[model samples]
Target: MGNALTTICATSDIHSPQYLELFKKALANSTCKPDLFILAGDIVEHNNIAEYRRVLELINSVHPGIPVAAVFGNEEYVGSEKEYVVRYPNVIFLHDNYRVIDTLTGRIVAVGSRGALDKPTQWQAKNMPGLIKYFRDLPDKISSLISQAASTNLPIILVTHYGVTYRNLTGENPAIHPYLASRRMENVIVNHRNVLKAVIHGHAHNGLVESIDIDSVKVYNVALPARGRIIKVEV
Candidate 1:
């Protein structure tokens, strides 16, 4: 109804030199210049802080002063290099956190978390008991952040390393769907659909690149495996 905010979302297991190059090209020549850049998650190959730095530098080169909001994926351990990533000028790490960006158009409230599963899978078993419990209980934690962002009365954009809706994971191996994302998280989005403009996530490499509606809110899979493309959403 008014001038829209353009957001470019890119995600999935980028850590290789080649993938990073592709990512840089995508952002530099985006279909539309982004007002806000959203890095959905799993950005590094193996907790390589240098790779994260490259991604940050590339993003800044593409869109100088634009704010970049990010979340972590299963591959990235929060404390491993999170402190370094946050040190970047305009990068905001939103793993289990929230940030509000005041754009020229209007206020943008972004909430993000690494998110977790509704049940334990093979991957969960590999982690220690404490971590397993933490991942399993992610739905409740992220839901609280959603509620907090909702109270801001600004357009809300959600970023996560895990897919919130099952439909968005289409084409991924069904046998490992439980390990990939959570359905409980989708319920949180459904409940707060009124103010939510878009939900972006990655992690299901085999997932479909689609835009589906949860009420009026759009949930999209921006994983790079299927296509090295950034999704553009107007808020």
Candidate 2:
């Protein structure tokens, strides 16, 4: 295996101008401009599609051609249905689905959902969509994509909007801990441990950028407050 692909990652609770500036600075200072620019979710506070469009426009301005894989967070909830607007060429929103991007070294499979962590216990993933329903029906939807990703036998990078384990749940209220992350996510992810090389998520601002080896698959919390950060994963 050679060195993994490099990319920038950051989580946002709500949209702010400060984030756009930080992204420019990161791009200016970095020796290698990220191949992929990832937004973990909660792009804007209000469900206003206009604001979402504006943010996406700004993001495209900063990193003109880089592919950005993003998911919506709970706060992005506006009235009823989830927002689905794809104007920017680089912006790819992963909701109840995944996308495959072919690369030179190998293929990269990116799976994400806006409200994925609200499922039932780890043991109840099979019923995650029906009876054990909580948040996004990702656990059920991700099965086919994961199977295809693993079938390729390439190093896969899982981009998500929610933390999979409590290791990244530090400095959060104990009362809302369960609400922030669910054990069902850990189960669904661990089931395809062989395919996934790493998992990155947000929604926990004070949480640490930590990694845990679940049956050898590494999960990372990529949220860095309101700033921009970079990460490179090797196959």
Candidate 3:
């Protein structure tokens, strides 16, 4: 028989207090015992930070002690990141950063971020004007992180809140594809295909294509509303 695969259970866009029950049901019904649990982003609704605890509790009840990693989503909002980190010291909140997880199968590097958008949304443009520059600089920051992660010689898994490629954004309006995800981010992933293994992301509620491959790296849109179940990925 082939060697056992390292399983990762991933999901996102819980929008807590809205889809929390659905998320609970999905996790309860899952049969896979994941080596790692990943929350791609938007765990809480409108920065209702307290609800994050409920989500974490549910995960712990189902699979305790597994490494949990997450990136920030737009709903998580700005200015509240440190609070989330302080509250859940256990969760690896990767905001343009990376962490390494050692599993029975092997060690995997997880690079996490809110991701970027090719064009700012109208709301963002009107409010967070500074985001234009931030988004412009994000790909390079993420690329550097991936490059550093590669130095470890471990398979790298990218976890982001925003979609990385338009290929997986089907069912959403093509005209706003730039607002949903970034081709620049896609370029970064493609550039590091030599070491990157898989990419997980959310924020595409209507995304019809849940998974796609860009030149070998697998990309998964794990938004809870889109999948209706927790995604189990074996690596």
Winning candidate number (TM-score): 3
Q: Write the per-residue lDDT of candidate 1 for residues 1-235, one digit (tens) a residue.
A: 2456555555556654548877876766677577777877778776665677788788777678877778877667656645646565467778687888765456688888877765556555665456677866777787788788888777788888877877777788777787777888888888878777888888777776567898888888887765577677778
TM-score-superior candidate, 1 or 2: 1
> Which candidate comes out best when scored by lDDT?
3
Q: In model 3, which regions exceed 4 Å deviation? A: 1-4
160-213 in candidate 2: lDDT tens per residue?
Answer: 666677755767766566656766678767888867767777777666545667
- lDDT of residue 7 for candidate 2: 47
Give each model's whole-structure lDDT. 0.74, 0.60, 0.91
Q: Per-residue lDDT for 179 in model 1?
A: 76
Q: How many clashing pairs per prediction, in order?
A: 0, 2, 0
| TM-score against truth, every candidate | 0.89, 0.74, 0.95
- Candidate 1 root-mean-square deviation in Å: 2.3
By TM-score rank, best first, the candidates go 3, 1, 2
Give the runs in model 1 whose Cα sits over 4 Å from its true position.
1-6, 85-89, 119-123
